[model samples]
Target: MEMQPATDSRLELWHELMQFYIREAWLLDERRFREWLDLFTDDVFYFMPRRLNIHRSEPERELSPVGDLAIFEDDKTYLTMRVERLETGMAWGEDPPSRTRHLVGNLVAEPQPGGEVKAKTAFILYRSHHETEENVFAGYRDDVLRPTAGEWKIARRTIVLDSNVILAKNLSVFF
Candidate 1:
């Protein structure tokens, strides 16, 4: 089989996608969840798997993907639930609604089959409380983007964190 190469147009499209994701990061940092939701496909699969860190000498243990413990495994339904929780005064995690900032960079994109593009992005999430200083969580995201209705929307997203242990008090803010 002949090897396929990414076309110039594909590369340009990938750069446009990176710019789009950067805009998304800004939206999240601004706490614009509704507008952020607009960037997703109707059948989006957004998930964040738990990070695991074993000793260097210990044998690596096998685990499933986002099927295992995940920070957020969301489809459109789950996303709606999250929004509802944020709106309802019942989601104790965000009772006060902590302040948060999301910084995204180091984007890499690769062309996939079926006009889909697989991209990875590095992110740093800083959160703060009324009395406390700021807390930061750094991670990366592996995402698949597909063109739908003449626009690119996230199809699947898998977030991999650098730290296995979470020190942040609550996962209230969207990561």
Candidate 2:
């Protein structure tokens, strides 16, 4: 099915959504975990499902968020706990705090029912930890955003990474 072109008013909304994503990336890169957590709704569903390389003929044996293992399948509470852990400065994976840059682009947003927006975008993350080669991760994200009290909030996000096997020692950073 094809999506209808956004109306003039909707175009303004799209711009706001794009800005929201840019701010989100900035927050993550700055390690502003508390503020980043605020961007999500109370019932947010954030997940990164495992991607598998299957033969072209066996397309059905591909990505799985349920049957296969996932790097993260966190709800708002789980995400809050992660933020708390990071704040404690005890999460070894982030104690030293890796330098990261998040580049987000190719955004497409469509207005959905219930005053929500469905958006898709591509992201490239560059991370450099203390004495290690830079780790690069590229992926696409699908998100459902809800407008609450005149502000946009993420209701759900599904990250689909480009790599079938991640080379990073730990996937601690938010995508």
- lDDT leader: 2
lDDT of 1 by residue, 16-122 (tens): 98789878978877777888888778898888776667666753442236557777788988887887777777877776777877888777787787988888889
lDDT of 2 by residue, 35-90 (tens): 99999999999989888998899776677856467778899999999899988878
TM-score of candidate 1 relative to the true fold: 0.84
TM-score of each: 0.84, 0.93
Query: Which window of 10 residues has the lowest lDDT sum in candidate 2?
Result: 1-10
For model 2, the local distance difference test gives: 0.88
Cα error, candidate 2, residue 162 (Å)? 0.4
Considering summed lDDT, which 10 consecutive residues are worst modelled in model 1? 58-67
